[model samples]
Target chain A: MINTEKIVEVQNLNFSYGQVNVLSDVNMSIHLGEFLAVIGPNGGGKSTLVKILLGILKPDSGKVRVFGKKPGTSKSVGYVPQDFSAGRGFPVTVREVAMMGRALAGKGTTKAEDKDVVDKILNDLTLIDSSEKRMDDLSGGQRQRALMARALAVEPEILILDEPASNLDMIGQTRIFDLLAQLNKNMTVVVVSHDLTIIPKYATSVACVSGNVHKHDEAEVTEDMIHQSYGGVEGCPVELVAHGHPHRVLKEHDH
Target chain B: MMELLSFGFMQNAIMASILASVACGIIGSLVVVNRIVFISGGIAHTAYGGIGLAFFLGISPLLGAGVFAVTAAVIMALITKDNKYRADTVIGAMWAFGMAIGIILLDLTPGYNVDLMSYLFGSILAVPKSDLVYMFILDGMIIAYILTWYRQIHAVSFDSEFASSMGVRSDLIYMSMLVMSALAVVLLIRVVGLILIISMLTIPPYMAERRSNSLKGMMIYATLFSLVFSLVGLVMSYFFNLTSGASIIFVSAICFFLSLIYDRVRTSK
Candidate 1:
């Protein structure tokens, strides 16, 4: 039974690309302001699931809804598509790129006030100095932030991200996580990541994906679960707290 | 040179160049920004099929090319939509087939060993009054479309997926762009031959892109640059007895090179 209050609802969702089953019978519901982290191994249909939710791809069978409407209806869904090709040499100004988020907001003419709004967004994202610079001139971390600024300008009620922190360093990663935490305070946010370390600190609920679906309810993700989810290695230390209970990560290991 | 401009043919060539350049430059800006240069090139060449059909059917070649290119542009637009990456391959195949069919049809058209060179290579020196009227109408339509939906076109050209998410039907906008580009190609077929049409389409904007920050600024500068290139090329062609179309493209090429040098020098400074 789907809760009517759910912002995103997916049931019996199966997706495949020409006989390769990526996801099967996946069921999940995300409530308003919920921060859900989907962690999985490579080739675990993480991106496939995100694309389906964004209405970019359709499932072979199942149901999906956004904000009590179709997947694409909520112009309020801000998706920063997995940065597959955002490299240097894409010739566009940071301000121009960010303005794209406001492209659909009932067009007439961009008033002088709209420029001020974009300027504020650039400042909030710490991109104000480089707003006039071409996208190709920005560093990788700055480029990622520019993409995020674009997404933020859309005023999305649901923010969906795919491996947004994969390219960032330790500082970059922490800054992005902090931003996500602040964003999730007001909107529903779903992030798909392969990283297991950052899941517990920020994710309100963790969903494990491995061609199958497993849901955990606010449980502190244990290292044993990570090992089980990622497939255990031979030399990795494993400790048992009790039968049927395992926790390998201690305070020292936590970043 | 001033006295030569008194002739109706010389005046017509000048008008044709100005009209065709403005239309092509504006449409070409969208093409370059969207990375649809090759597809626009394909549309320009494929217009030959329409010319051949017009000759065979005893109608105006411009009308025939207009009808045929518009139809093909729509089909090309549809096939390419939802598959932006693979669009060029489909357009390339269509371009080759369209050209082949046109040549075959031209050969089969009876009572017509018509000088194919004039149409294929362009005869700006021989442009008629009727052609000028046609150019005027096309120019009007182009201006209206650009004025009414300029912002939407800019957004779609920059990033279509983002545009569509914003309630703009990128499919519709993409199709409109293809149709307009094809029409512009059809208009330029007589001013500059199909062989040289894409150069006119690309060169002006390429030069303008170096000096401008916004797309609109690039287009306006391109129009002014194209006008200067056309006049210089015309005078050069008249004096040297060279082909008008080829001479025009040569002057534009020089401008493109100069623009590149200027940008390099400025950046170094």
Candidate 2:
């Protein structure tokens, strides 16, 4: 049961980094309660598109709206950036990091309600015991979960994550995806991932981004989409191991 | 030490040290966590231009330094906000350019009998009572700033992108931090001199960063460390007839290395 209310709308988006065109003529829309997975090869403007959607980067010529307003003008969106360890070596605890989510949402005061929200999110993430621990002391998986807790602490209507599980192991990746799947039942989720194998299991829809965006209406990754998004490289060795299915999406290339 | 306290000049130096520690503890923690030590050094050196302008205009050097430092900070913030990769090059050039401007301005001034060494290496013993008032006011402002906007500053420092996404005005916060760093540099110039100010702004915070679990804790511990080093270094300078700024920095450096060794030994165990 997908909600038809459009939560994010992008139109004729054109973006470039100092004359090197990244996204051109891209258009996409995300409805309420959508779980959109943005996928592409490196330098394919996957992260750039997410940034533009979050209003972190403005497009050259296009319109991006989140919740019917300009991106970043609304406080209903939470983001977990690709660089999860940006706070490493800094003297900030896990609870403090999560509390930062509430920093901009309301008057900057640590009310008891805000503390309760942070504690609940930390507990949900299984980080209640380490809530007082420094961010530098956490393991990679723990750090990822802590950052996710920060994003969730906002209690946002939409959550956006860029490469949330890039450095995680198989089990760690599965756990993160499971959490996202659980969270998607309530709020809209936008995830940028390079792992093609795991996305089909959780994503409600997929948008293949290269020089432009090709959105699929369902959670299915075809070989043609991968080939098209990867610039149609001849016999590109992109391994798409589909779970709960016996077929490989791409042909096995010999060494 | 009891006898020394009887002297008004010694009392003023101690007051200045305490005020300087407060500024360094708060602002230096931000500087270290943001990894903006080089930017801070650039701002401090650039303040020399202000000192020279003040001498030429027959005004207070600290006033001149404050104006020049804040202006330099704004310019640095603007240039570095978008051009992060080349920030060091820009800051380095500005650092030398400012010193050269100061030298030229001082040379052009008539009847320049000022002891430039005092400004370069610090004469904390000669600090007047008026400067202490300014230092006190600056400390109060820094404290008020932290109390009022601690959460926003924390968010911006930890992750500016996420902060911005959540409507924290991260760019504004970043610029304000740099401006605050410049003001802290101004507050420190009298106690440690321009060249040694960066050391005071970094060493204690760096040591505290390893021991603390929160930014506030880091600031408190850093302030304590800075206070101890200032007192110890002031006493050593009095007894050994040494330069006050250099002695203070020496004390901090010794403690920094010892902390490093202690961490290594404990970690191995």
Candidate 3:
């Protein structure tokens, strides 16, 4: 049963790209302070749904609400997109990028306060050392942290990240998840990841998106569910196997 | 160089170059960082259509180019935003088509003897006082816009998705930036001409990108470099009797290549 203290609510959402249906009658809810993990096969509309929630894309039909407001209208939601470039090779420093997070919050704020907020966030994210470095000069994991620092700098009630640690190593990924876990104590965290190694252990709830959405509060993802999840999608068998084991693929192969 | 200041036209040319650099530096940094050089290029060439339309209607070519460039910007923004795969083909077509329109329009206007070469290259030495006034106002507006919206522009340019999540209108900012690029093209065309506008827009920003650590720094460096290149080229043209526009572009090209060397040498060292 869905809880009453929902931070995000998606009701009867149906999205299509011209002819093909990306999502159909999708329904999901995220409660406050819950670490929600959105997982799915590639092209299963996982990122699309996130984009809709970020107000980057508008759904054809249905509703996506964050904090009782439309996705784009909500200032309390922070986002770190997949492969976020801080204007790569274009002289945007980590500090400057992080400061951009405070641009919208509290009008007519002093520059010193903004700088202080950005500095603390960078320190918390362990990005203070490289705060002065150009975005392109940072390693993938460092860049990912810079993006996270930027998102967290906004001090959002709900922070969403699409494949936040895809560029990071397992150690780096663990550190990020630890950081997310710490943040999730007070703030809601929504992470879109394909890596199943950490999700089963860390996520308070997991939502598997594949044409349809299946939310599990216990965060256990069975191999059968993973296999059956990709049943509707074509040419996803290889990718499914790539992420982990597949019971459905063998079943389909036998057929 | 001493006698250059004695001539009113020379003084005006120097002042115009400084103003042009200001516009180019700010807008050029955005254009480069946003990866919309091709769009700017298309606008530069497509602006010719506006110039031609202006000639046909007996209006100022700058007005026509401004209108035409904005229209081109709208079209470019639409397709490029929705479907990026078709952007190249669309840009290529728009680029040639705009130039062709301008040429045809210039051909149709019988009584006026508009120097097509001047429009193509530049007439920096012949920059009228009225045009400088226009550039001055535009330069002020541009600086103010950047200063007022630097943070928002930073958000949109780097991670628009994050920006939108933070309640910034990334799409509007992006479109506005493209339109501003068109405006920059209009301002620079008289100083450098349509053919060399991209150079003014991209070269300084490209060089400044490596030297600076922030967009503001990049913009400042770009402005300084643009001014230096403009003056150096202007002086070279004045002494050698070369075309001012080509000379400026020549200076930029040289600096670009030299910066490349500097980057390589520093990296290797």
Candidate 4:
């Protein structure tokens, strides 16, 4: 059974970029404590959907609700942006960037507890040694973890990452997924990724967004669903191959 | 240099330098970090239209420029904040238009004999005590705004999307910073003319960014750097009998190249 608590709900959501139809009638419901992987092809509105949920971009029509309120209302949703290098050259320290996550931690004021929280996150992410180092000075993997530490410092209920491991290699991607899986045990996690193989391994629920959104619990994902969701347009099934908790697999979907 | 400071005009120039340098320091770090240097240049140049309008109406030309600059800054900020590729074309068009208006208006002013070169290139030595008050007020405005809202500015500048997710009102903060920079550019005109304001706003901050670890550190260090550059430029102007604005920019440009060399060596190490 799905978790009873509804953390995110999207209804009839439509968004566009100057006449380009990005999202059309996208509807989905996310339950609490579920590691949701939002997968799709490139330029298929995955980032756009996440942006709407983050309240950075508004929809052309329809509603986006988080915790039974507007997406930006709660400030409980932590976000890891896609482009880690957006403003990296601005001379801000890693700790300073992480502290930005604390903006909504305590009613717009930093308490002693907030500092403790940041310190713990830095240490856990193995970023304590480089906390004072400039953001641009860190390696790509280190920067990603730093950003994750920043988001986790918010102590959010729902954490969303936009293609967290895009530029990373297979090993790097698995490392990130491992971290996300650990984080999901305590809080709801939503990751938008093009890595199809991660669905069965890490995600509790899958939301495939390609022009539209289709939500599938672990048991509902099938070869036809995977094909239509990802490989459908190319007249093939975009097969995902990975392993985690043992589950029965359809013989036909097996590659 | 001491003899130069003894004169009223030089004293006023020094005061103007302090006021403008501080404003540029605080505001310039933002301009460079936010990558809005080109937009600021656009605002500075567009302010020339205001100067022309003010002259046409027989009012204070500086006041006209301030109003025009702020307006241009806000508009340019809105248009180019997200779309930077279109910035040069938009700013270049406005730059040419502003100069055209200023030239035509100055031509129309009956018996107007003010040296147009002074406005094009700055004549900091000609600034009077009265203009210092405006500089101080504008300086106060920029400082108070940045200090009162440092967290918001810091968050928004580093990563606006994350800031917005944290309910920082990133767009509002972005607009306010751009508008504040517009006002700062207005005050800066007395030191460096509209033509040279971009370099004045960016050079010290660019050098400071390479050394400092935080935005606050960058702002403070950049201010000191600007102060030194202006002082050295002023002294060089007195000795070489060159245009003060051009000399100041020359000093800043030289420091900029040197900082690049230093950063290259350090990073290579």
Candidate 5:
């Protein structure tokens, strides 16, 4: 039973990076408890769409809203950026990073209840054992999980992640998607991923963004959609491996 | 050491070292973790413009540098925050531009032959009693700011984009951090001078980063390291007639290298 409550809405959004148009006349909406995978080619404005949704980047001309309010004005969104290791070598413990989520949610961790929330998040993410360890000491998978723990600690209604498993191994990627599947039971989950095969397994919907955005209400990744988003089969040689079946996701093309 | 402590000058120098250590220890950790050492260097060098302004206006040189440093920091923060790709080039230009202004202003000062070496290097032994009061206030302000906004600062330093998404006002926090760095530069200018300030601001925090698991712990450890380096460097300078600022930086550099070697050997084992 999907909730039809709209959590994110964008209307005629046009964005550019100094005249180089990234997103043009883009319109999309996300509902509550949605597991949306934003997929596109490199330099196709996937991350830009994520940033705009998170209010990190404002569209040049458009109306964007999250939780029925202007993006970034609401406190119900939790985001994990693409570069989770941006703070590598920073002197911060796993527990402290999770606690940052609490702080950001306008709830300082001084109270026992707040601390308990953070601890529970860390425990749920299987980061309890390494809670005292520095972020630099954690493996890539653990670091990804730790960042997830931080995002979850916000107790958000919507969770947005940009390339959460880009640096992980196959097993690690599976683990992260599985974790997202579990998390999607309660919150709206939006992810920007290049892993086309893994996305159909978990995402309830897909948004193929190039300079324009095409929203699919179903999880199925079609040949025409990929070809259109990637500027036809000649421009994109995408070999998608779904359920261990190695096959081209696009139409037949030259060798 | 006891005999030296009995002297007023020695007392002032020790006090100055402790206050300088406190500023560098707290602010320096943020500087190192954020990888903004170069921006800090820019602010320190830009402070010379303020020093020259002070001489020309017949005001306290420290005050001039403090005002100039904070102003430069705000400008740097604005430029770097928006135009990250070209930050280094802008900082380099500002660095040279600041020095040029200071040189011109000092040259135009009528009948005042300022000892350029004292400001370029440091004159810790010649620090006036009044400067100590300013240093104390600055340390207090830095501590209070950190305590008030620890979580925000931590978030911004770690992942600013994520922090911004979480309503942290990362740009504001980043600017504040830069302003604090500028103030820390003012605190250190008397102990290490403008040129040697970056080492004092970075080396101890870099060492502390490896040893601590939390930002607060790193700050404490860095502060302690800075205190030790300053005191030892001061004593060595007094006994050997060496430049105090250079001696302090040399001590920090040696320790930094030794820490590196120690980590490498331990890792190999």
Candidate 6:
């Protein structure tokens, strides 16, 4: 029987961009309060699937539900998109950027309460001191923190992240992982990342999708299983290769 | 002064400045925030082609400019959508193409002894009553649109994909922004002329950024600064016999420098 405790349910989800089919027959159920990490190679539909769940992109023929409602219709879902290397010049402050999520909450008439909610999120992110600093002036890690703070301002029951550790160095990546762990305690967290180093330790459940898809709960994750999914030969756990490339065992993952 | 106010042309200039200030201020804030200043500059200059087209077709220059500017804005938007690095290159090519086309068309219009300098530099003194009315209506639309759609606009400017994921229509929002920019560019050309229009569109918002937190507040401050500067410029132009557009830009530049100094002083403490 399907789990009644599920918060996110995707059934037979299929998606594509133009003629290229990215995701097909993807069915998954994420229980309430689960921390799920989605790891895949470059162009492996990781971002596409997360985008579908977040309502940024629609699946051709599938169902996606968040807390029993359509994905984007759920006010309780939060998202942090990959930092796409926007250059300097925009003069937005960190506080103002974070407030975007709160501003989008509900309809129009709740500005006062919205401010209070955003303030709380900033406090939780430890970003209160630098809130007034311009986003352009922030350090790389600080900018990422501000992005996280923006997502948290939604007070989401579920949080989605895409390549949260892409450009971060070791320290920055660790800090972001720690922050995600803290957030996972309060919400269902789903992360789409290619940083395989983080998967074994930080992830409670790991889902690998290339052409085919598979999932392993925290206890069920074995090194050989990771090698099989990622096609790392000679009995090493799957590791991120150079430049986000994947060497997989099965040609079926190449659809 | 009351005698000067009695002149219909003087009243038209005042109304035109007010209308132009509001449009330029709001749209300029978006341009500055989104870092599309150079593209907007290209759009303004490229609009000169429309003025030439209007002369050739015996239509109003404003109508030609409207069509020309919107077309340019869309082209620029599409070209720069996926390629941010090539923005300047594309804008430069379009800028030269627009000016060249305008000059060629203007030459082809026989017996057209046009006062081209007035179009290049604004002739606020010649602003028609009907144009003033158009400006007012457009300003009203800009105000209503900004207030009703502030959050969505802010989100798109900051993080488009995230905004899209939140169910905000980023594409619609982007198109609307371009349309507003087109309207602003057209109105600004009427009051400040194409040569000096970009300064008015960019300077006030640049000054306001030193003090404001949110885009909404930045826009209000920009409007106030633009209004004050344009008024001062108008009076100075009257007293000193200067070009209306250049005088206005001069005053805003002073404001920009002053705001910078004020920001530095506050931070030094």
Question: For every model shown, what is its TM-score relative to the native structure?
Answer: 0.86, 0.94, 0.93, 0.93, 0.94, 0.82
Worst 10 residues of 1 chain B by lDDT: B158-167
Shares of reference contacts reproduced by the candidates, in order, are 0.09, 0.73, 0.80, 0.55, 0.69, 0.44
Cα displacement (angstroms), candidate 4, residue A92, comes to 0.9
User: Cα deviation in Å at residue A253, candidate 1?
Assistant: 15
Candidate 5 segments exceeding 4 Å error: A107-110, A219-247, A250-255
The numbered model that scores best in lDDT is 5
Candidates 1 and 5 compared: the better one by lDDT is 5
- For candidate 2, list the clashing residue pairs, or say none: none
Residue A31 Cα positional deviation in candidate 3, in Å, after optimal superposition: 1.2
C-alpha lDDT values of all predictions: 0.76, 0.86, 0.84, 0.82, 0.86, 0.79
Q: In terms of TM-score, which candidate is stronger, 1 or 2? A: 2
Q: Candidate 4, residues A1-255: lDDT per residue as tens digits? A: 558788899999999887688888888889998888887656678888998998888899998998888877676888998654346678888888788788655433547777788888899888999999998888788888888988988889999999888777778788888989888888899998766655567777777777788777663444455545554433123334222211333243454
lDDT string for model 6 (B1-269, tens) is 77877888888888888888888779999888777788888888899999999999888888888899889988887777657458789889998888889889999998898889878888787788878877788788889999899889888888888887777887788877877887798888767899888898889888876667667778888888899998888878877889888888888898788888988999899
What TM-score quantifies how close candidate 2 is to the native fold?
Answer: 0.94
After superposing candidate 4 on the true structure, give the runs of residues whose Cα lies further than 4 Å from its correct spot: A107-110, A219-255, B81-87
Least well predicted 10-residue stretch by lDDT in candidate 3 chain B: B77-86
Candidate 5, residue A31: lDDT: 86
Query: List-wise, what DockQ does each model earn?
Result: 0.23, 0.66, 0.68, 0.57, 0.67, 0.38
Candidate 5 C-alpha lDDT tens digits along A6-120: 8899999999999698898988899888898887767778899999888788789999999888887788888987565345788888998888888788755467888889888
- Kindly list the per-residue Cα lDDT of model 2 for residues B114-204, writing each as its tens digit: 9898888888888999999988898998999989989888888888888778767777888899999999998998888999999999999
lDDT of 5: 0.86
Selected candidate, larger DockQ, 3 vs 5: 3
Error of 4 at B60 (Å): 1.2
Stretches of model 1 off by over 4 angstroms after superposition: A1-4, A18-20, A82-91, A107-112, A209-213, A217-255, B82-89
Q: How far in Å is the alpha carbon of A111 misplaced in model 6?
A: 3.9
Counted clashes in each candidate structure = 0, 0, 0, 0, 0, 1
Instruction: Mark the regions of model 2 whose C-alpha exceeds 4 Å error after superposition.
Output: A107-110, A219-255
* Cα-based lDDT at residue B87, candidate 6: 76
Better of 2 and 6 by TM-score: 2
Q: How much is B14 displaced in model 1, in angstroms?
A: 2.3
